[model samples]
Target: MKLRQLASECDEGPCPTVWTIDEDAEHVLVQGFKVEDEEALATMKMPEHETTVRTPMALLKRVAREHLT
Candidate 1:
C-alpha cells in the first residue's frame, strides 16, 4: 500500500510535521511538534515519535457519523 501526503513540513527544522493519507483513507499518519520551547523547537527536525499518532480513518468517520445522528 502507498501512503499519500496530506500535509507538509516547514522548510527547516522544528516545524509542524506533515499529515498523510492513504488511497482508501483507512489509515492516517498525524505528526507535529511535541514540545513548545523556543530553543528546542529551533533545533528539532520533526516531532517526537511519542507525539505523533497513527490511526484508522474509518474509525474517525464512523465516530463522526454516529455523533451527527
Candidate 2:
C-alpha cells in the first residue's frame, strides 16, 4: 500500500502504534509510536520494533488450538 495510507491507519491500543511511512525511490521508511510508563520510556525511548507476524485469523486459530479441549 501507499505510505500515507498505511500511516493513516495507525491507532493507539494495547499494542504498538504505527506513526508514518515515508516511501522513497530507493527505500521505504517505517515509523511508529507507543504509550509507555515514564520509567520504560526513559530507558527505551520508544517502544517500537521492526517485526512482523501472520494475520489475525492465523493467530486466532493457533490460540484456539492451544486452548481447545
TM-score per candidate, in order? 0.29, 0.23
* Best model number under lDDT: 1
lDDT of 1 by residue, 5-65 (tens): 4433445664344333556565555554345565655565555453433345554454455
Q: What's the count of clashing pairs in each model shown?
A: 1, 0
How high a TM-score does candidate 2 get?
0.23
lDDT, candidates in the order shown? 0.48, 0.38
RMSD, one per candidate, in order = 10.2, 10.8
Local accuracy of candidate 2 as per-residue lDDT tens digits, 1-69: 455322222255433222224545444333334334566566655535633322334434433454333
For model 2 the local lDDT of residue 1 reads 41
